[model samples]
Target: MQLLLPSDVVRKMRKHMFRAQRREIGGMIMGEQIADQQFRILDFSVDATSGTRSKFVRDAEQHDLVLKEFFERTGKEYHRFNYLGEWHTHPGFSVDPSLQDIYAMQDLVDGTGGVDFAVLLISRLRWFWQYDCSASLFLRDHQPVRVNIKREDPNAKTEGEL
Candidate 1:
């Protein structure tokens, strides 16, 4: 499967990461599955104050509000638009999932009433407006798989943008 991240969303994430400085920050990723094997990241929540130098735990309540608003605005399309996964900054570290990160995602997908699969995006600011990121897909009872992430064309507009 392929994940498409819009430039605008990256810009917003960069700003949040930059502002957090050495600390890690993260939030929920909400988007749409545009094709059978393609997912487009439409929006995300930034929990700027939820992390420290080495760890970040998302504020689900805040993220839930964001997701609720998105669902309402999107006319509650559950099949197409829904919660995709989570993302967080690594800051002064490599953009690789820590063991804790891996376990968390695995538990999420393995839990009852949880999603069959989820994506985890680990990123760190490299320079101004530039970031190093790693994407992984976690599935229930399966090993994590690396996912290809592509940046959306700046000139192209998706339905969310319109």
Candidate 2:
């Protein structure tokens, strides 16, 4: 499996991850899945803070507002970029999904509409956010199976770069 993330998404995630080094932070991931094994991360939110040093939860209303506004502003034609998954940081420990984390993914997938599948992206970053997306086995085996993160060209801006 492969997960392609935009440089802008990487930049935003790293900013929040670096700023909140002592606690955990999280948000929703928006992207599209291509073929049997490719997920392209087009956008994400990072301001939702519901966590301690070891765990994090997303702010539902904040997430909803972001998603609603993003989709509304972008128009429905570009709505292929909907809810792809969740992304959070493990402040001090490994980025591997704990049993609890895997369980939570089930709820997210059930509630999220218009998607055949979802992913959980974890970052084991200290000063930088290293995004890692996993395959479906994450929920089955209760562990994270990482995929590739392909970046955009150095000179080119990400899809929605401003």
Candidate 3:
């Protein structure tokens, strides 16, 4: 299946993705809801490889924990919230799943519902022929699905505190 993304959201994703690349850290986000899709991005998180986090970072290990917790927490946040997928950054102008990425995708599928989720990859910069920060989806059947990445502003206020 193909994913459709708004032009503006793609632009914003590129901006943050580059920031992560420069910091040598991985970026994460909640992919916006598609027009008629039944799923939504519950929350987003990032693990940077620069500054304090970079000193001793293990994204692969840490990501497992993060994903686990997120799944548990979001399951309670809303009855419909669930682990949709994952997004990471690639320090390049073109964002494509490398061999390692593909392996990771397979691992995620093996561990979870697989293609029922998505793994978004972003580039450090935009290229005329590359996807700066784009979303790719996978199916439990090991089919590759494309999702249109969208940009969304984080909520600046907290619940009941706003």
Q: Pick the candidate with the highest TM-score.
A: 1
Per-prediction CA RMSD (Å)? 3.7, 5.0, 8.2
lDDT of each: 0.87, 0.67, 0.50
Quote each prediction's TM-score: 0.92, 0.75, 0.55
Residue range 1-162, candidate 1, lDDT tens digits: 888988788888998888999999998898998999799999988899879999999877888999999899788999999988999998888888999999899999998527999999998887755777889999899999999888886786643221
> 1-162, model 3: which lDDT tens digit per residue?
333343454455555555554443453444334345644454555665442311212355666676667657655453344455556555532466665566666666766534446565444454433344556766555766666544333452322110
Best by lDDT: 1
Query: Which stretches of model 2 miss by more than 4 angstroms?
Result: 33-37, 110-115, 126-145, 156-162
lDDT for position 49 in model 2: 56
Residue 136 of model 2, lDDT score: 39
Ranking of models by lDDT: 1, 2, 3
| Ranking, TM-score, top scorer first | 1, 2, 3
The residue-by-residue lDDT of candidate 2 on 46-156, one tens digit each, is: 764567888787778888887787677557535355676778877777777777877787655455434445677777564455544333323332444555666654577
Error of 3 at 118 (Å): 3.4
Off by over 4 Å in 1: 156-162
